[model samples]
Target: MSIIVDDDTRLVVQGLTGSEGRFHGLRNRAYGTNLIAGVTPGKGGQDVEGVPVLNTVAEAVSAHGANTAMIFVPAPFAADAVYEAVDAGIATVICITEGVPAHDMLRIHTYVHNLGVTLIGPNCPGALSPGKANVGIIPAEIFTAGNIGLVSRSGTLTYQIGHELTQMGLGNSTIVGIGGDPVVGSSFVDILAKFQADPETEYIVMVGEIGGDEEEKAAAFIEAELTKPVVAYIAGFTAPPGKTMGHAGAIISGSSGTAAAKKAALEAKGIRVGTTPTETAEIVAGIARG
Candidate 1:
C-alpha cells in the first residue's frame, strides 16, 4: 500500500488555472488520480478540464472534500499556497514549485510540522504511488506498482532510479521526491517510517545528494526503526567543497555534509550504500529477489 496517496486521495490543484497546473492536473486526473477541485484566485467560477475552480483552499476542502493539495503556484507565492493548504486542513500538500525563498519555506515548514500536516516540497517534483495516483509531476510510465518504496532529494535522480527499478522488473509501491530545498517539510526519516509501516513495501531505495546532514540522520533512523532493507546512493561524491551543487540545499559547508560522510553513516547502520544509481538499483533488486 502507498503511504500518502492512493485511489481515495481526492486532490485539489492550488494553481489549477496556470500553465503547469493545467497540464499536470489533467495528466494526474487522466492517470486515475482523484483530482476533484481546482483553486485559483479570480478564476473561481471557471473550470479546467471540467474540474471546478475555487478561489480559496478552504472552499475546495469545504466543497469537494479535498484532502490532498498539489501546489503549482509561482515560487514567490508558493509558501503562501502551502500555508493556505495547511490552514485549510489539507492532510497532504505537495508543492512542486521551485525557487521559493528559504525564509518563506522555513516558516511554512514549522507551521506544517506543528499542525501535524504532511508537506512534500516547495521545490520538488512531487510523489506518486504507482498504479494508484500521481500527485506531482513524476512521469507515470516509468514506474509500476510492486513492493519497493523510493524516497529521493533530487527529481531527476528519482526518475532515473525509478527507471532502473522498472528495468530490473522491480516495481515501486511509492516514489517521493522530497525536494532538495534546505528546509523541506518532510525528510528521509519521515518517509522511511511510512514505508516501514506499509505492508506492500518490502525493500526500499533512498537517493540522497551532497550538502546536508539529512542523509546521516536517516541512517540513524534506519538503524533504530526500519525493519525493511534499504539501499541508498548519495549524489555528488566528487563535488568540490564549499560550493553549491545542483540542489538548493546541496552545499558542503564543512566536512559534515559531504557524500563520503553520508555514505559512512548509512554503511554503519548495516544499510547498503551504492556508489552509483544503477548499482543501487541492482542491490535493491537482489535484496528483493531474496
Candidate 2:
C-alpha cells in the first residue's frame, strides 16, 4: 500500500492546458494514473489527453470527484492554484512547479496543515505508487511494485535510487519526492512515519541532500519510533560552502546544514548512511539479506 495516494486516487491536473501540465499530465495518464479531469481558468469545456478540463477546481470535484490535484502552473500563479485546490477541499495537492516564492509557500503550508490536506511539493518530482498510480512526475520506468518505500528531496536522485532498488530486486511500494524547497509540504519524518506503518514496506531509502535539518530530525524519529530498516544517501557531499546547488533550496548557510553534519546525525541514530546512491542500495540490500 502507498502512503497518501493509492489506486483509488482520482486526479485533476490544475494547469492541464499549459505546456508543463499537458506534457507530464499525459505521461501520468500513460502510467495508469486516473486522470479524471483538468483545471484551467477560461479553458473550461476543453479536454486534454481525453480528460475533461474545467475552469475551477470545484467544478472538477463536482463533476468528476477529483480528490488529488497535480499542480503544474508557472511559479508566479502556482501559489494561488494551490490555494484554489485547498479551498476546494482537495485532500492531497502535489505542486510540481519550482521557484515559487518562499513566502507564498510559507503561508500555504500553514493553511493546508490546518485543513488536514497533504501537500507534496512546491518544487518536487512528485510521487508514484508503482502499478497503482502516478500522481506527479516520477519516472514510471524504473519503479516496480514491491516491499520497499522510498522518499527523497531530489527528483533526479529519486529516480537513481529507485533504479538501484529495482536493479537489486528491491521493488518499491511507493516513491515520493517531497521536494527540495526549504519549506516543503511534507518532511522526511512524515514520510518515514508512513513507511513505518505500511505492512508492504519492509525497508525505506531516504534520499536527502545537504540543506536543512529535516534529515537530522528524521534520523531522530527513526531511532525513537521506526522498526523497519532505513538506508540513506545525502547529496552535495562536496558542494562548496555557501553555494547553491541545482535546486533553489540546496544552499548551505553554515556548518550546521553540511552533508557531513547530516551524515553524522543519521549514522548516530543507528541508521546506515551511504556515501553514494549505489552504496545506499547495497546497504539496504545487506540488511534485507541479513
Candidate 3:
C-alpha cells in the first residue's frame, strides 16, 4: 500500500493552461492518475486533451470531485493557490512551482497544519507511489512497486537513489520528494511517520542533505518511535562551511548542519548511514536479501 497517493487520486491541475502545468499534468494523466479537471482562471470553458478546464479550484472540487490539487502556477501566486485549494476542501495539494518566497511558505506551512491539509511543496519534485499514482514532476519510468519506503529533501537525489534501488531489483512502496527549500510543507519526520504506520513498507530509505537540523530531528523520532530498519544517505559531505550548496536549505553554518553531524546522529540511533547514494541502496539491498 502507498502512503499518500494511490489509484484513488482524482487530480486537478491548478495552472493547466500554462506550459509547465500542461506538460506535467498530461504526463501524470498518462501515468494513470485520475486527471479529472484543470483550473486556469479565465481560461475556463476550454479543455486540455479532453480534461475539462474550470475557473476555480472550488469549481473543480464541486464539478469533478477533485480531492487532490497539483499546482504549476508562478512562485508569487503559489501560496494563494494553496489557500484556495485548502479553502475549497481539497485534501491534498502538491505545489511544483519553485522560488516561492520563504516568508510565503512559512505562512503556508502553518496554515496547512492548522487546517490539517497535506501540502507537498512550493519548490518540490512531489511524491510518487510506483504503479499506483504519480502526482508531481517525478519521472515515472524509474520506479517499481515494492515495500521499501523512501523520502528525501532533494528531488534529483531522490530520483538517483530510486533508480539505484530499482536497478538492484529493490522496488519502493512510495518515494516522497519533500523539497529542499528553506521552508516546505512536509518534513522528513512527517513522511516517516506515515511509512512507519504503513504495513506494506517493510524497510525505509531516508535521503537528507547538509542543511537544517531536520535530519537530527528525524533521528530523534526514529529512536523513539520507528521499529522498522532504516538506511539513510545524507548529501553534501564535501560542501564547505558557511557556503550554500545546491539547495537553499543545504548550507552549513559552523558545524550544526554538516553531513557528518547528521550521519553521526542517525548512526547513533542504530540507523545505517550510507556514504553515497549507491552505497545506500546496497545497504538496503543487503537487508532485504537477508
TM-score for all models, in order of appearance? 0.98, 0.98, 0.98
C-alpha RMSD of each candidate structure in angstroms:
0.8, 1.0, 0.9
Per-residue CA lDDT of model 2 for 51-162, tens digit only, reads 8989999988888899999999999999999999998979999999999999998999899888888999989988888999998878888889988899999988889878
lDDT for position 171 in model 1: 94
The worst-scoring run of ten residues by lDDT in candidate 2 lies at 247-256
Residue by residue across 83-198, what tens digits does model 3's lDDT show?
Answer: 99999999899998988899999899999999888988767888889998999999989999999999998888889989998999989899898888888899999899999999
- Candidate 1 residue lDDT tens string, 164-280: 889988899999999988989899999999999999998889999988798999999998998889999999988999888978899988676899989999999898988788888
Q: Which runs of model 2 end up more than 4 angstroms from their true locations?
A: none
TM-score of 1: 0.98
In angstroms, how far off is 50's CA in candidate 3? 0.8
Looking at model 1, how many pairs of residues clash? 0
Off by over 4 Å in 1: none
Q: List the residue pairs that clash in candidate 3.
A: none
Return the clash pairs for model 1, or none: none
Task: Note the Cα lDDT for every prediction shown.
Answer: 0.90, 0.89, 0.91
